[model samples]
Target: MMRFDNIIIGMALSLILCGVTIGAERFPPPDFVETDHVIPSPTVPGPRQDIYEYIDAVVLLAALGLSSYLVLRRRSRRAIFVLMVFSLLYFGFWRKGCVCSVGAVQNIVLSIFDRDYTVPITVAVFFLLPLVFALFFGRVFCAAVCPLGAIQDLVLLRPISVPNWLESGLRLFAYVYLAAAVLFAATGSAFVICRYDPFVAFFRLSGNLNILIIGACLLVISVFIGRPYCRFICPYGVLLRQLSRLSKWRVTITPDECIQCRLCEDSCPFGAIKKPTTDWPTTEYSRSKKRLAILILLLPVLMFLCGWASSGLKTVTSRMHATVRLAERIYLEDTGKVEGTTDASLAFRATGKEQKELYADASNIRAEFKLGGWFFGGFVGLVIGLKLIAVSVWRKRTDYEAGRAGCLACGRCFQYCPKEHERLKKIKEARAKY
Candidate 1:
């Protein structure tokens, strides 16, 4: 039975790999689009909307399906490893140097400043669908779906202990980043989250020199630290964490049964699991309750400030004006009526009249900023309220003992789960003895 299970996992992985290879050969690595809005292409490339979507959809659906199957069936986790391999293959190898969610975050941030900026559907899907999944499934997308997160997770073979203070601080930082990204996205100022995405250059295999350098640094860091993006950065992960906290059900160290062998603690690479605090139960409960209260009070203020900070008039104007002007200039030069007067027209047109007034009138930078502030304030308030109510209802330790927010559902812990491992070992030993 164990052999059969392992073979099934291996075969599943092989199929996924074959699919990725075929898909990549057909489409090739995606070219990065410089702007947020769709670039007008007279000749539309194949059926795929863009490279990001083409690869992401296949990777996401496959990962989600496989992970869901493994989780639900309570099966061997070799499939999770397979998904990780495919993510790296598609993102790092096949689709090298293409814009992705990381770039999408940056594009979204850039858009805040540039009124002409509109998020690509492909970009938006990568950012949002994972969030939607997280709302119900608790960071399942981060685990199996996010190419960037999965990349780091794969590289982190060596285990290093993270200090509690550092881990706590990093988690807090993710929240801060999430707040900023949401505020910026809501205001139409930018996608700050994607701009600093370190994995982009690696995935796309090309980008700005600085961005590529950043990507290299992050790749190097992943070798030493596990999932630095999920732990410290990744605005989307931050939101997922909040959602996961309130989630009714989440991935658990033990699902149907537990032998309490403590293997999961050793196997868990990310240090996300907290050994269920059995003694001093009341104290822990009280602490969680208190913290929940403080978070509720503070989230609104933080949201308002982040929204204001990201969308303020000065910030939006300065960031967007340059991009908007560049885009406008390009549009005019492309469309302008001129016969053998390209150079003269460009030079003449670059020195424009009433550009400042025109740009200002065309952009709703100030209005967007105000709207972002209001929206974030309300959104934050709502999230906090939901969490409080959830905590109040599921006040039992068992209910709260599921998993942390943004869990990634990668089943990394399953490798360490003593119950499952013991069962597998017994089956293998029995087969050998027989």
Candidate 2:
């Protein structure tokens, strides 16, 4: 087993070097001077081959299916880890992390908002398969299939537990990120999620120096803290967390019944194992009810304030649009606030477009941002309000169970359960008798 593991590591390292060479050859920067006046293409460096795209879709389907089987039916952590390594190599190093399910979300949202945009079938498939699986089998995708998650799981050498309160607080960023990604995509402004993806740089073995540094930092943090990105930074994880709550079949720490051994108490690095609850004091319960009522009454007020405040920032948000940026740059230049012309500004001047017309277009885009900001901020406020209420409320459980929304179904706790060891022993004895 050690030899086999060494072979996999060696192969992945070799591919990393090869991917770097290929990345350098394929993604040379543009020669034109950088400027904000020109529209940026949404395209990223992905595979151009139609055959490869189809192959990727097929492989993704197979991996998700196998992951479900391994986690649910076989209940084998070794198998899951092997498959996770394969997925990291195939999707991360070889495929360069493009056309991923995480980024496919922008394509889906853009298709809904823009009439002219037609999402490719492969992209749609990549986006939906994990969601469908999460609805039925919990987060099998996050267990072993996602290249991003797999890479992080690999770097977790000395895992530490995050306080549940801190975990809940940090997860608010993912909600905000999802809202911003959707708002930007709906307005055709940007794919902010894809643009700032930290791990993609590691996968492709080359990227912006700033992004590479960020990716390295994340990996270093992951060694001590388990999957900070998945828990707090992944936008797609927000969707999966909701869906997994409604899943039909989910990961259980014990194969049979819970014996309350407490052996698996510290098994989960993500703090996903819930301890059996004790009854709360009557006074505590009464206080919680009062707090809940107050928060329920306070929810709409928070929403309104957040919405009103966010709408006021339309000017800043709208600057993400090329026309708005060009208008700002032209105004600065016209007022003698800045020096020379950029390639984009020179190109726009050659087109004989009036500055007033550009400003009008920018103004219209800001008007759109005004409404989007409302929804974005209101959604954030709603999430916060609901989170407060949930934290105040307490649920009762008699047995230690896995958190439906928080568990990655990684099978780490399986080895810690004595019941599991007993089950394996019985099976071995039965096989010997047969």
Candidate 3:
């Protein structure tokens, strides 16, 4: 069976690699001469790029299906790891990290808020496929298909477990990131996620120097920490975590059942396993009850305080938008508080537009941020408050179980489970008799 599985993995890898090889040869970079005309933003794919996008979408769908089967049914970490490599090569490097599902999130949000925005069919498919798969098959996308996660997973050499409390606290940043990404995209401020994507420099092979440094740092951290970006920072993973909780199928450490053998306890580098729990002492329960109640009462107050605080950052936050930045630049120039005009200011002047119109547009953008800030900060507070409440509650468990929301479904724990080995042994014996 092991030989059979290896043969299967090898064949699949060959097929994927063959496709990648053909694609690389077929789509050499365009030889356009550089002129003064500004290069168009890739919001919409061109004729050749459109063909690549469709191909990418098809590959994404196939990879997700294969990933789900490998994680949930095969329970083969080796197979999953093989698929992960192909995904990293095809989606991350070969594709140059454009038209990715992660960045497509902003396109979806922009379309939702702006009537004029139209999401490309391929981009829309890229965004929705993994989420739909996640609803049915847990985070198999994270397990073996997401190039970002695959890169981190491959570099994980000496795994260090982050403390669970610290991990939960750190995860709040993802919620904040998601909210901020939505706010910026919705208001045409920016796609901050794509702009600041820490791993993209490595994927595209060239990018902002600071961004490349950041990506390098993250890769270095991944060597010891095991997918820090996926666990603590991925805004898309934040969505996947929630949807995975309601998945119809999920990865389990043991094929049959958990036997509390303790071997698998330390297997997961991500620290996603939850040990069995005993009832809390009555005294502990009483204090916990009081704490829970206090947290519940504080939730509303936290939301209000956070919203007000965020609203106060409207001026700073709104500056992220081009119109707002231009307004400020114009104001500085008019007041003689700074140097000569920039190319942008000169361009605006060239348009013969009145200063008031720019200010009014900036003001409207600021207002949008003001409202968005409230929602963003209020969401942060709400998440924080819920985290506190969740910690205060205790649940009884008799068997070691994977955390539904936290598990990446990487199948790393399977090898440590004696029950899993037993199941495999039985399958081998049955096959031998046949």
Candidate that scores best on lDDT: 2
User: Candidates ranked by lDDT, best first?
Assistant: 2, 3, 1
Q: In model 1, what lDDT does residue 382 have?
A: 49
Name the runs in model 3 displaced over 4 angstroms.
1-49
lDDT scores for all predictions? 0.62, 0.91, 0.90
Kindly report which residue pairs in candidate 2 clash with one another.
none
Query: Candidate 1, residues 270-389: lDDT per residue as tens digits?
Result: 667665444446656777777777777776676566556544544344344344444455446557632344453355455674545645643555555556555654554445455444
Question: Model 3 clash pairs?
Answer: none
How well is each residue in 254-330 modelled by candidate 2, as lDDT tens digits?
88999998999999999999999988768798888899999999999989888888889999999888888888888
Judged by TM-score relative to the true structure, which candidate is superior, 1 or 3?
Answer: 3
Measured against the true structure, the TM-scores of the candidates, in listed sequence, are: 0.64, 0.88, 0.88
lDDT of 2 at 145: 91
Best by TM-score: 3
Q: Candidate 3 vs. truth: CA RMSD?
A: 16.3
